[model samples]
Target: MCCLISAGGLNLIQLQKWNQAAVAKLCWDLAHKEDKLWIKWIHTYYIKDQQLGDCVIPQQASWMTKKILASRYIMLQSYLPSPQHQSMIRTFYLQLIGDLPRVQWKCLKFGNKARPKACFVMWLCLQQRLLTADRLLKWDIEASPTCVMCQQDPESHEHLFVTCTVAKTLWAKVLRWSNNQLCIATTWNEFVQWGISSAKGKAQQAQLFKMVFAECTYALWTERNQRLFESTSRHVDQLAKDLAVICTVRVPPGLQTLIHSFQF
Candidate 1:
């Protein structure tokens, strides 16, 4: 059977012959005369395993079958089954936010209109690219992992991007420029959820929020890279300017016109 399947030269008649032989053997093994007869009849017209493993039958397969198969075969071996622990972690993370954005709720891949920043953050986190002061200390990148801008104990994603004084000031400037009023979040999760949930009604406000969020994240990351690589000092003005340029470039012309009109 294996050789017949692997040989690949079987035409319709040959395929039918092979299938009948296989099914007859299976039926004899099963010891069901009716089932054996049914199998023989079925294989008479419908040559089973004609293409064998050469082609995938998309019509007969489920959409998630591949993911399920891969996950079972691959991930199950490496990642232990800890559903309770993972659930606890996810719950703890979600507790920081009042409401989750619809995009996040749906678990859609990042860069969609709904949760672009969430997607980017997920990618960064998965890639281990995010530089926390703890990570810097552990890697011996610096003598201390203390935040340079605030001189705080440790600079984490939450602290450096959202809670640090320099970050706060930069966000303040950005908010002022965009004419938005937002309560500063102390946690990364909270800030993300806020970005997702806030500005639910006004399309303009939502667009501005997305643009500003993307800009701020890019600027903060850029500044961190410069400081880490070149031993350069943090520059809030440059960060702000970079953010402005990012927003200007990303925001659509219609929205830009609306923003300009609002300013006037």
Candidate 2:
């Protein structure tokens, strides 16, 4: 039988020598009959080149063979689970399934006037990964299921961030103070969509709106944590003033003039 020396200097035997019955027996011996479909799939897609002379190994990959080899190459490259490999799989899955809805990811996390920590917290809130009381309860952590800000509704991403009386009141004061006529949203997703759609016109206005929105989200969360851990609470008006102060400190010089115009 002919043998080819590959680039790695390994003598490779051609496909003709593979014992089909031995492979089938190996598959059967490894698992039950119900689990052998994968073995069948591998055999079906991995057909050997019948045109090649017996025992003659192919020396190089052609365009037709590149994809076939690349798939196996990628699987071999990541023997252990890792962030890079997980990201590659996530990208592949997203490409296969197509894009999600616009409202699913409308929150801006970067390129705005919000503080970096505030942006990150707001981003997590948008992603529904923020440790809201509901999320904590779901994780079996010790937390009250009721909203800390309002104490009138079940605590959740939506209720705490948008629909709570405290949140709604704070938003009303903020919108009126900023000279924005946009409507308040009742859910986290809708809030994100509103934040994206309401800030129209010049880039400066949009950026200032985002900065204010992020600061509000961050301040609300911090206030909630303070209430939870320190047994302290701030009134809705006070929380709104805190949010305004944060926005004033973070806004650009161009926006500082308008921010100065608003009374806290």
Candidate 3:
């Protein structure tokens, strides 16, 4: 199962990449460790004194053996790693994984203090993959096209998080509580960029902002769900207060001290 993950917040091994790495290890062992029993067996049985790529996977081979042999083509594509060298396997692994570009909001989405659920929501928001009214209607699903909070514009990631009246009020209160009263974000892009540009380096304000930003996104989404599914809603002021309480608990001691000093 593919679990939700990010570039920074929580580190986890991608199973697919890890499997590729394991296969690369097998290739390395075949080339270097002739003394190994498994390698000896492969040479005696399937390989029969032939190159790895020349030998095809036998139909009757064990599942694990087939798995290892299956990687022969892939292993041959890259320059083979050095014999018995640690960097050899790592080089192959990196080659197999390839270099993928990161999203602009990666650090913010996976910050150390950011809650994983909130970070996941932020990820959806950044990808514009949330089930907003625009997406639902496009899918031919019968749903109101208007923003539930303001009921004035089409519900979308942009409106729900930035331009909705409830959202703007909540953001205002939150920014004030975070001692960033002058900061304003009218568009979704601005909201994301604010988090990225403001949180430059490991400044205390930056860390606190990342923590606060995560909590705000999570709380706003929760409020939207409650209003839609439960027919209940929190006032913007309450959301701001609740965000403060959550951040107080989530941030490290240094950030807690920084937040507590802000005038409510």
Candidate topping lDDT: 3
Candidates arranged by lDDT, highest first: 3, 2, 1
Off by over 4 Å in 1: 1-129, 136-143, 199-202, 262-264
Those runs of model 3 whose alpha carbons end farther than 4 Å from true positions after fitting are: 1-17, 43-66, 76-94
Please provide, for model 3 over 158-249, each residue's C-alpha lDDT reduced to its tens digit, 9 standing for 90 to 100. Answer: 89988888888887888888876344788878877877886656888878777777778888888888888899988888888888887888
Q: Native-vs-model 3 lDDT?
A: 0.75
- Give a tens-digit lDDT track for model 2, residues 96-210: 3334334323435435578878876776677678898888898899989998778789999898878988778888888777777555576667787887675544566677787
**Candidates 1 and 2, the one with greater lDDT:** 2
How far off is residue 11 in model 1, in Å? 40
| Candidate 2, position 207, lDDT | 70
List TM-score per model, in order: 0.52, 0.58, 0.79
lDDT of 1 by residue, 191-213 (tens): 76666575444467766766566
Order of models, best TM-score first: 3, 2, 1
| Global lDDT scores for all candidate models | 0.52, 0.62, 0.75
